[model samples]
Target: MNRYPTVLTIAGSDSGGGAGIQADLKTIAALGAYGTSAITALTAQNTQGVRAIHPVPPAFLQEQLEAVFEDITVDAVKIGMVNTVEVARVIADMLDRFKPGFVVFDPVMVSTSGSKLIQDETVAVLWQELFPRVDLITPNLDEAEILIGGQIRTPATMKGAAIQMVEKGCRAVLLKGGHLVGSTIYDVLAQSSQEPLILESDYIESRNVHGTGCTLSSAIATYVARGNSLAESIIFAKEYIAGAIRSGADVVTGYGPGPLNHSFSPVSMQIVS
Candidate 1:
């Protein structure tokens, strides 16, 4: 019997189903990997905005992690929206213990609508503990600025932030240029051992990009779980996300910004049975 590549997401739940754990699971399944999840928080959210957030206790979060690690051999992990310092500590401990082969972190702080998802205190712990454990971290411009305690206004600044993040112990950093103002979107993939790689794509001007970050990170994890090299995985994930964004361009889900086309095709979930 052939075993399927498995990817796990430890993230918050989005009731809107366009982002967060919902987007992660959809992206993983769409990429032919077995998707699993351990929800860290539950948000009553939609395209309009986040109405409420309920964080799961650290002990319960640990229990969920233990249950998954005990039974399933998780090939890769995509971490998102850790709401508290305790939750961040629990995740850091788990990373140290399990030592998963490939870990992709989306340091989700501010929402697309400009609301903070993680606490200020937890941000420090995330940098000191969880950030160092991941194989790669995917952060938007706003998050990059928060991580470095400065502004990232240009490509040069983004590169500097990525380098600093690598110095902080992450093996590599994928600093997104989506938040920058321009017709062209540039994403930098930098590693300590290699020169920075720039991925430039034409900006798809659409407000329906609710879960692009979560989707991209999850797709990268899925590709890694399927044995793709780091560079290759990120490139493929970018292509997948770009397609999803374009596919869902005009469709509106909620009153505010909508989500991507995670279920755009049946081929999105091509499991190896």
Candidate 2:
């Protein structure tokens, strides 16, 4: 029997359609997977900045999760921007209950402007209840610093932070070095049992990178859902996002940082047995 390799994105909603649930769904679909969602919050924002956020109640979030998992065979899961501790707990419970095949968590703790998004309590809950359950935790430099309480200034420091996060309970860590200074970017992938793998790319100088993190993580889940190994999935996701960025670099969507061209070269929906 064949069915679409389904990926469920549990995250917030971005009215800008560049990040959170919007980006996740777009990335998943672009990578040839069936996309499902369980929205955790709603944000009013554009390429410039976020103005407000409306969180979904924890119970309602649980209902959303159940509605999808009860019927669909979610081949993978991508989690982003869980603002409240209660919402984090609800998502943690669902993951425990469903035990999905693959879980990629993008710890969206800091904003583009360097403001903290999740509370300290919510961060604690993520570490205690969710980190162990996720297969990979993708944290940009800012989020990684918050998680580990240190600075990541170079690829070497990024490696150290990724290892520290793995030691703190994460099954694996992908510490993004996009925020680091340079034309070349480094993303370090680390686990307790294996040496860290440093993935590098020539950073594209573009303001249209509002949803790169969300897109990368969701693409990772989509590839894994399509039967790629975790390492292979990360590599493929890196290539996909690069193309998306380059494809949309010149197109202006808003006054500030625009979004990637997610459908630059989308694949057909993939089938798996």
Leading candidate by TM-score: 2
Q: How badly does each model clash, as a count of residue pairs?
A: 1, 0
Tens-digit lDDT track for model 1 on 130-242?
Answer: 88788899999999888899999988888888888888888899999998889999899989878888889989989999999999999999999988998999989888988
Q: How many backbone clashes does candidate 1 have?
A: 1
List the candidate 2 regions with Cα displacement exceeding 4 Å: none
lDDT of candidate 2 over 96-171, digit per residue (tens): 8989989999988776745456878898888899999999999998888888889889899898889999988999
RMSD to native, candidate 1: 1.4
Error of 2 at 69 (Å): 0.3
| Candidate 2 residue-wise lDDT at 28 | 89
Any runs in candidate 1 off by more than 4 Å, and if so which?
268-273
The stretch of ten residues in a row with the least summed lDDT in candidate 1 is: 264-273
Lowest summed lDDT window (length 10), candidate 2 = 110-119
